[model samples]
Target: IVHGAKRVPQDAVSDQCPEPDGFFADAEQCDKYYQCSDGHITEKLCPDGMVFNDYSTEYEKCDLPFNIDCSARSKLQSPQPSEHCPRKHGYFAHETHNVCDKFYFCVDGKYNMITCPDGLVYNENAGICSWPDEAKRNGCSSEEVFQFQCPKVDEAVAATHPRYADPEDCQYFYVCINGDTPRRNGCKLGQVFDDQSKKCDWARNVPECADWYKGRLTDVQLAELENPPTPRPRATKVSKRKHQRPRAGDDILV
Candidate 1:
């Protein structure tokens, strides 16, 4: 019984703080820090060769040694350095653990991370992403990655037959309809689209044609088939008169 008065347990200190726009110390862990922005918080760990310094000012927040090569560490790596990430409308190497298959699109220095969809890769030579097979066939290096979706066809071409070979898939094609999103279709086996004939035909017959074939007729061909030319009327046969004694008599009278 050795106490002047029983000490009351102080209420647990609140760890809450105002919203932050930059780096700050972790509320529970001294070795960690929180990256705050837009009323959100993200836990982060220092990159390799860096350490968390709590005394850093706002301008020099997340203070780490100046000698550390922070840029080498990808954005996916913990405690992303502010300097290396791409700004708005700019492109940068994606943070991928295995294949470099993704890229970040900084919208106004924030927002989305754009990537090539399935069956595609980014092409650096074209300065945009594209299908890997296309890029390779087009002589683009394997190292470069780029791709994009089908764009609107030209007005002149749109009014005509809208068939176009797909650069991504040889077996697939795009059929533009009234300048809207092109309809995608596949070619039949053992046939291909014949540009000269403007129809799908046997691959053996049209070696220069694309790999896939739809076997569908164009609008003009269909119209011609529907309205065929009418046959001309046959000439009437005339009877010839007998030229025996009548001929001799007619000559004498004349």
Candidate 2:
């Protein structure tokens, strides 16, 4: 029974003081618990991925036993001592999280994995992620799988020659004036970038060939195109043949 600001016992109305700070299990709910503080009781539930830590100083809170040290507590529901996580080879922590912009190497069971959200790779020396060009200036290798795919172009070239024809679209080309975002531009009608000549020409005159060629190929050049070499089969051991002397009669007949 409760009176104005104090809780009174059922048998005696005189017992009106509030309870001390402590954890108390709820009577009706198994997953819920009560925290008594300053004569007032408040109900709370542990957060997801964690369980109530009755032995903690703040007994109402929840935590992973292995992650917290509860040795000072006299009564612990389940105490778990911290142990070393085994060394993982080649496997990085961020890779498990499906993040490609940053990488991590485990050391002594713990690693701090950081990410470069600006389409850059993490530089170990600089302790931050930076543009590949800037990373190179700082003497750091800019080799990482970026979260986004951006064409690799030299800064000087990107600034001067920002427009280039896309091989797939003879009538359209891409412009990278900002060195980041690309814009598409269409060529004039009746003409397209000649992949063979590397210049605008009649699409009908351009021979059907790979776009990588810089200029039109002659008949001899077309015939000289090399094919990819086929993979060779693995060699197998051959039994040695026994040597025998040639027959004298057989040699004379030969």
Candidate 3:
């Protein structure tokens, strides 16, 4: 819907007006189409980053390439490149291979850089943020990002999705999916990962992690966080309206 008339590339396709009033797609180009009205023909181009959806001749619709199949008419207009945008529109990966979490979303040859959530990488193929293992981008695998490997276990234990303590940080842990792929996770503030119990618990209860917050928090601060004050209950308001009895001749309200 965001179209720039000045940016649309000019292309001529010598075609007859098939219908009196309708839109028709060009045979060779996915972004080129024709508008016919009263036996008159006009060549049209979709926005730079989109393709003409030729599912029907009744309506003119332009959509993103991800949502439309353009195999037969895969040819696209020449890109109007800009800073960080190879094309006028679409999701693009970071120029640096090692920088996996950031990407660029381009519109009208303008760029908006975006960063994936913690422990996630931008999936160029799917155009969204996803787990490093799932994204499968070279140099950005789960092993490379997390630097943790799932311990070898029997099939039975592997199926249970076991948790393991992070060797470097007591407040963080890793969950092995199918006992192979390691996913980084963290315990909430004031808590530490308990390897024996395989869950987050008070720092004081976990022997190895008892002094995990030694320099970070004081004794009183840890106690206050571990034992937070309970929330007060709200007072209920009683209705003051009295119910009235209907008389014999009164119309009943169903």
Top TM-score prediction, candidate number: 3
Best by lDDT: 3
Better of 1 and 2 by TM-score: 1
Any residue pairs clashing in model 2, and if so which? 18-39, 19-39, 196-215, 196-216
Question: Whole-model lDDT for model 2 versus the true structure?
Answer: 0.45
Estimate TM-scores for all models: 0.23, 0.22, 0.75
lDDT of 3 by residue, 211-243 (tens): 999989999999989887789998899999999
lDDT of 1 at 6: 26
Which residue pairs in model 3 clash with each other?
Answer: none
Cα lDDT of model 1 by residue, 1-254, tens digit: 01112222223312332454665665444334555555355556543323355565253233333322233332322332334344333354455422344565443345455666544555533435655543343332232332224456788876773666656654456555554434445666554565556566555566655333345555444445445568899999886966566554465654
Clashes of each: 10, 4, 0
How would the candidate models be sorted by TM-score, starting from the highest? Answer: 3, 1, 2
- Candidate 1: TM-score? 0.23
